[model samples]
Target: MKNHYCVIMSGGIGSRFWPASRSSYPKQFLDFFGTGRSLIQQTFDRIKKIVPVENIFVVTNQRYNELTLEQLPELKPEQILLEPCRRNTAPCIAYAAHHIHAINPNASMVVAPSDHLILKEDEFLNSLSNGLDFVSKHDVLLTLGIKPNRPETGYGYIQASHQSLDGFTKVKAFTEKPNLELAKVFLESGDFYW
Candidate 1:
């Protein structure tokens, strides 16, 4: 449906990536694995299958406006929202939400980062379809997550209720990058998702 929209967040400078990812050209714009398509382009190709090209928007820093166009020429200049300064994720999401909501009052949006690499396309898209359907029907905030499948300390973990309402678990608490011991505790409890 035209009411379905996607907002791709691509404003980060990606300093952690260092040599490969510079301020001028961050990781999102680089073809990390020789995929021909850059990370952001890969992200766009996946989302465009579900959301209309016109309905999809990219939120990036003002400096990357031209770079975004160079990479995603299908999107009109207006579809790219440029931030004069970096205000991080919350503000960036709010900015995109305000614009999308104003254009279509009934718009259902999926806000995603530009750097995530998902290997299973069919499964991811299927889950995305379900999440979008669930969000469109109710006035609620929804996010996709997978149960901890590996030992990792860098991911943020969400503790969800044992019960499920309408096929969605209620998030009880969130722990961002817990220590190794805490991560093990979550892995054992079996109620946390990363």
Candidate 2:
């Protein structure tokens, strides 16, 4: 099997989080819940189970390089790709992809958000395994979307298709967070969760 690689997207400044999440110290580096381990530290521990320490890469802004290093001392310098400016996800993924692709032509990678909260560990792991398995043989972009639990205006919704591949559902369409009434209907339907 080809080595499964993961590129964690940890470059966001998280403006909504406000006072706690500053540009200098983003949420991923903060231990908001007093878990002793910061969010980024927790992420590394979780992903290491499936991907090797060497195969997992972290891409962040040049400014946060030292902070990331301070937190994740196990990582070598090459494993962290530091960007000079905030070019957004596309450029960051592109740069990392090109480098990884050059090193391993048959590489299959998963790009994930660093600050997501998943309640069900088993379900999340199953979905992750399914995604990694599917991507190994398929040349397609894959992202795992959570169901909208409430009609909150904060997040987007994924409309899943009936089709299932290795227990993974395909996203038929996406719905923006609706108003109170619409969100109520979604909750009543029990089809989505946030």
Candidate 3:
């Protein structure tokens, strides 16, 4: 797994979860489920199962540096790439990719949010390992998605073919937060994942 890397994106203001999550203390640092570990810690645990601890990097806002270190003491100080400012996901990812490339030129990375809660962690890890393997040998970008239980406006949706292709389906298009009407239609179609 030396060639594998994981990038955790934890810089979002988490405005959607406002009133509870503010700029100084975002949702990723909170333990909403009272699990002792914060959301980002949980994410790190999950990713570390597949990727080596040293190979995992966190790309968060510079402000969260102390909080991140306090929570995840297992990581080296260099593992955290604090952004001077929040420029959104694309730039955050690019920044992480650039830094990680300097360390491992032929690395394959799995980029994920720091607030996700997975119930079936073993299954999720298995799927992630498979995706990492698939991407390592092919010059392609593969997205791992969850089967949405609800039409959540907070996430992007992937539209795929109904026909399964070797346990995978072809992606038709990506839909931004669709209205309730479109979301219901997508649910009925049985091919949209968030």
Candidate 4:
């Protein structure tokens, strides 16, 4: 826990899931599953098992600062990295990574979305542990890819190379929101994952 850091990205407006999710109060602040805890709270809870409470950070827009605070009251103000404007997940992650690296150069961080559902807790943690272990000893950027159970056109696809190291395949390419036909081909290839 000393060197482990978790960054939860919670700046999305969730326009697709509107009505239940709005700009003022995004989906991360709502319990979409009616599980008592909001999405951000659930994400924080899961990551806290592996990361210390103080080491966890939330990256959100300045507008959503109050919402983030309301959802995650345990976090200090500094733990919440507020972006001046919405620049998507890449910039948010980069900001969090820079902040964490400045504090602890040896830190290995996990950047995750605030609104995601993980039903298999044990498996998820085990995979995360494996990835962390792999990265600790190697100079590489590791990303966990989920094997597609269906032709999911909504999510981007990662094409894996033939080589495998520490149970992780090299990402050959990334395809974004492919058409239905291309999605079917990816599913049948047995090499792509969402």
Please tell me which predicted candidate would have the highest lDDT against the true structure.
1
lDDT, each prediction: 0.91, 0.79, 0.89, 0.89
Stretches of model 3 off by over 4 angstroms after superposition: 162-166
lDDT of 3 by residue, 1-194 (tens): 89999999999877888988888899999988998988999999999999999999999977899899999999988999999788988899999999999998889999989998899999999999998887788776788877788767767899987665447666889998888878888877888898
lDDT tens per residue, model 2, 8-76: 878989787989999889898888788898888888878777778889888998888888889988888
Ranking by lDDT: 1, 4, 3, 2
Supply candidate 4's per-residue lDDT for 148. Answer: 95
- Alpha-carbon deviation at 122 in model 2, angstroms: 3.8
Q: What TM-score, computed on C-alpha atoms, does each candidate reach? A: 0.96, 0.84, 0.91, 0.96
Candidate 4 residue lDDT tens string, 53-124: 999999998888887888899999899999878889788889999999999998888888999999998799
Badly placed stretches (over 4 Å) of model 1 are: none
Question: How should the candidates be ordered by TM-score, best one leading?
Answer: 4, 1, 3, 2
Candidate 4: lDDT of 32?
85
- The residue-level lDDT of candidate 3 at 116 comes to 88
TM-score of 2: 0.84
For every candidate, C-alpha RMSD to the true structure in Å: 1.2, 2.6, 1.8, 1.1
lDDT of 2 at 21: 95
